[model samples]
Target: MMRLSRKAWNNVVIISMLLMIFFFNGLHKKLNTQPVEEGVQALLPEQSFILAMAFPELKIERIGTSWRSQSQQETTWQGNEQQLEQLVELWQHQKLTIANLPVSKISQTSADYVASVWLAGEQLPAVYQLYNIDQQYYLLDKRLQRVFELEQADAAKLFPLYPF
Candidate 1:
C-alpha cells in the first residue's frame, strides 16, 4: 500500500476545499440572481398617464380612467378609455436598449416630435424625442442617449389624434 506524504495530503485537502467553495459560490449566485426585465423602472399607477407632445404643443391627462387633451385651439378633447389604456400599456412595457450613438452625435434639430410622460402625483415627466433617421423610427430619451427602435406604426400610436 502506498501513502501520500504529509505535504501532498495537505495540498490535496486544500485543492478539494477550493473546488467545493467555487462550486457552491457559483450555485448560490445562479440560484439567487433574478432576471431583470427591460423597460422603464418607473412604476406606473393603474390607468393613469399624462402625455405631452412638442410639435403640436399638446397636453393630455388621464382623469378618472378617461383621457382629456388640450389642443392648440385651446379646446378639450375626450379620449377613449380603452385606447388610452392600450397606449399607456405600450409605453409601460416598451423595452429600451442602449443607443449605439451618444446624445452628442444624434441631432435633434430635425426631430419631428417630442413626448413626455408623467404619472399621477408625479411632478416630473420622462421625456422622449421621436426622430426619423434614414427612414427608420427611433425613440430617444431627451436626457439620456438610450434609444428604442420601433416600427412606424408603433411610433404613430404615441402621437394619437385627439377628438376635439
Candidate 2:
C-alpha cells in the first residue's frame, strides 16, 4: 500500500469535498426548474402577459412564488399538474411569447389588465387573475368556466367544468 503524508491527505480530502459540492449543486439547480413536466414550452407573449397579470409585479418579479401559489390554490379545488401541463402546451402552441404581450392597463387595484394583442391579425380580449397576494397568475380555461382548475378537454364531447 502507498502511504501519503498528513498534508497530502488533507489536501486530497479538501479537493474531493469541493468537487462533490460543485457537482451536486449544479445537478440540483437544473432539477429545480424542470421544464414544466415535459411537452410544455416557454410561455407565449399574450399568454405570458395574461399570466403575468396574476402576479402583482406583472411577471417582472416573484414569478416563482406566484406560480406556486396559483398551483396550490387551484389544486385545492381539484386541479392537478396534468392540467397545468396541458395548458402550458396549449400556450406554447398558440405562438404567444411574453415579449409580444404587454399589459395595456391595470384596472384599479385588481390584478386584471386591459391588454392589446394580435391573434390571426385581430385584436383580442385577455383577462388575468392574480393570486390572493398578487403574486402569480391563475390561468383559467374560460371555455370550461373554470378558473385555475385544470381538466383535460374532451374532443368529441361537450362538457364544461366550473371553478368555485
Q: Report how far off residue 100 is in candidate 2 (Å).
A: 15
lDDT of 2 by residue, 27-73 (tens): 99988864432232233333333332122211211244233224213
Supply the TM-score for candidate 2.
Answer: 0.27
Local distance difference test, per candidate? 0.62, 0.35
Give the alpha carbon lDDT tens digit for every residue of 89-159 in model 1. Answer: 77665554444555665564566677778755667776777777778777777643466665677677665
Per lDDT, the best of the predicted structures is: 1
Residue 71 of candidate 2: its Cα lDDT?
29
Model 2 regions lying over 4 Å from their true place = 36-164
Q: What is the lDDT of residue 30 in candidate 1?
A: 95
Q: What are the RMSD figures for all models against the true structure?
A: 9.4, 16.3
The TM-score obtained by model 1 is 0.55
